[model samples]
Target: MTQQPTPDAPTVLLVDDEAALADSLALWLERRYRVRVAYSGREALQTFDESVDLVFLDHNLPGLSGESVLEELSRRVDPSSFAVVMLSAAPGDELADLPVDAVLTKPVTKRDVFDAADRFVGDAPEAKLD
Candidate 1:
């Protein structure tokens, strides 16, 4: 089994309606970060807190869209403190006004995930992609 990083590892929340994808991504991220999974946008908003260092948010969700969740999160926390990476199956041009740190297209590779982590969290190594 892979070892969890140190206690001070950054916490990341994965919000996606696709259970399989979310689960797989969570497993990958857990290697170096504290990962939380929320299947719906409503759950994402409800479960998020100040402790979250980064968020991988899916654009399409059941109750609320990723944009709505980001809007609500922005009101609660300072944008600079945490990063939000919006995930979408299509172009995310409409979400340009949102205070997200980055936008990643769907079917993201492990390298893509790590690249975002490195961009927002820093100190990320170019490890092998799953």
Candidate 2:
């Protein structure tokens, strides 16, 4: 039997400068995870903690880039402790050798994000797009 998450489910951070994408992803994952939104890489770093279970990070931002943010995160936490997925409109070649768990191309649908979330949060509830 699949276990349903309680009020204190694992946290998932959605870091994207695009408001619509971030908001949509948050809504999609909120049922099974506590979703936090960060509009910029700096904001993401400010809100990040050892407790975060996953991160959907956008490659481009006004200030610090997602690659830089990932680098900083690697320094502060163990690579295996949390799952970090880079979302980039550009080719993934630029992010080669980064400590992220995966790299997703931009314009990703809610289903795509949900699928990734499922890998990290086993037995998580299905994400209903409304």
Candidate 3:
């Protein structure tokens, strides 16, 4: 059996090559969860840490492929430590072979994203104030 991490506000790593889209999604997620953004797979890998409770990875990325990033992450993090959600604008057979927790199609709504985050992270925390 896989050991689960202690429940907490989810820390999501959002990886996308599109800077504008990535920023928009990051902003949206930041309102609820701890959000991290990476413009490429290499950057995503660099930003990855044990704190990341879930991942939203874009299928098509420049430089290293998202699959490669996932493979590397699988090797570094415990299988149960985090969940991987593959996001793609286009469908492909290659994604079927990945060991991700879930796959979501692009043009994703805020609710859909949050729902996925909640599924991985559990309940949301009370908003923090300055």
Candidate 4:
């Protein structure tokens, strides 16, 4: 959504029921990555593809819970294809068993976002398709 991304740059799919937070994160991440925003689980599913390198997924949503979304994603794609950072207002115990690369408690800070990005979606250039 941030212009066409540079091919080597990473892509981040940010999913949250909170439009403000989702948009704000997209604005911040756009400087470094191609960012896609989805305010609902259905949209997240529709927007995601193999090109996405990272995901910032919110655990609690109205129509489709993040848990459900994760389940669907696992079923739909290879688990190793992308990194998922699950976000939630709920306690960490609530998310301990989920199949995500990482988990962040919400009211997440800029540090939290970048820390995950730094760890999972670092500076490596994506492999170019011929």
Q: Estimate each model's TM-score.
A: 0.89, 0.85, 0.88, 0.88
Which residue pairs in candidate 1 have backbone atoms (N, alpha carbon, C) closer than 3 angstroms, thus clashing? none
Computed on alpha carbons, the lDDT of every model, listed in order, comes to 0.85, 0.83, 0.84, 0.86
Give the count of colliding residue pairs in each prediction: 0, 0, 0, 0
Question: Candidate 4's residue-wise lDDT over 1-130, tens digit each?
Answer: 3244356788899999999999988887776678899999999999999888899999998899999988888788897999999998875676888889998888999988978987998954533433
Model 4's TM-score against the true structure = 0.88
Per-residue CA lDDT of model 3 for 1-130, tens digit only, reads 3223233567889999988878888888776677899999999999999999889999889789988998899899886899999999986888888888888898888888888888887766855553
Candidate ranking under lDDT, highest first, comes to 4, 1, 3, 2
Q: Compared with the true structure, what per-residue lDDT tens digits does model 1 show for residues 1-130? A: 4466566778889999999999999998887888899999889988899999999999888779888888889888887789999998996568787678889988899999988987888753333334
Q: Worst lDDT window (10 residues) for model 1?
A: 121-130
Task: Give the CA lDDT, 0 to 100, for residue 40 in model 4.
Answer: 98
Clashing pairs in 4: none
Steric clash count of candidate 4: 0
| Per-residue C-alpha lDDT of model 2 across residues 12-115, encoded as one tens digit per residue | 99999999999989877777787899999989999999989899999887789988888898889996899988898885566877777778888898778878
Tell me the lDDT of candidate 4: 0.86
Flag clash pairs in model 2: none
Candidate 1 global CA lDDT score: 0.85
Model 4 / residue 5 / CA error / Å: 5.7
Q: Flag the better candidate by lDDT, 2 or 4.
A: 4
- Which is the winner by TM-score between candidate 2 and candidate 4? 4
